[model samples]
Target: MTDRKLALAAWESLFRAQHEVFHDMLADFDGTDISQAEYDVMLTVTRSPDMTARLRDITANMLISQPSVSRLVDRMVTNGLVTKCADPDDGRGSLITATDAGARAFRAVATVHGRSIAERMSALDDDELRTLRALSDKLRRS
Candidate 1:
């Protein structure tokens, strides 16, 4: 049986930790060409084949509303960070592809952000990191 009080306490701790860590990590984008949202969109796009991904897929991965993602994509398009075109396979959908400049910018910020993440998470050893990953995955799946 679950202990209700303990569960709430654990949830609060987890929430606070995630919030603080994320807040600290935002500094990784300081003075960079892209904001954190752009980095997130490119993170999904650059991982897909040919630096391309479906708009729906990007929206699904984002924490923001679909409309917000759409607007951000439009801005990225205006800035020449990416190209968006109607998806041939899905008439109502679109495809987003990172431009050469976009990929370069993502890479530059990723390097610094990756290092910052490592430094911050270094508080946990490899085994703890693995355990945390497993737990987080399990929770998401549940």
Candidate 2:
């Protein structure tokens, strides 16, 4: 195969393999009890000091759309894991805040996710980890 064609094929293969490994790792996560999207939103909201963020803030980094985020926030609110509030700066916008209970839940789920990542990635040497990070970043930027 030509060098360029071979390289592209290798990249595609590697990307798929990486995605599969991530899915496997996610499957083993303690937050498997929660949908990945839900866990992501909760973690983001709870990590901030205000423990609150606008709907637009959540949607930006998330994989889902604003409407989906709103619906998920609604469900989380109903579950008592989060509460909806008016954005102080924008009354028309909604802000999401984790409850004390939500914070506790996020902690529990984070532990699980952390453990899964640690266990699966533990075999990589420091140099390998650095190389992986560089490569991943390069792909992200591209």
- Model 2's TM-score against the true structure: 0.80
TM-scores of the candidates are 0.98, 0.80
Q: Quote the lDDT for 96 in model 2.
A: 89
Which candidate gets the maximum lDDT versus the true structure? 1
lDDT of 2 by residue, 1-142 (tens): 5599889998899889789877896674442445677788987897777898777888887988888888888998998888998888997898888888888877787888888777778889889989989988997798
lDDT of 1 by residue, 1-142 (tens): 9999999999999999999999999999999999999999999999999999999999999999999999999999999999999999999999999999999999999999999999999999999999999999999999
lDDT of 2: 0.82
In candidate 1, position 132 carries an lDDT of 97
Q: Which stretches of candidate 1 lie over 4 Å from their true place?
A: none
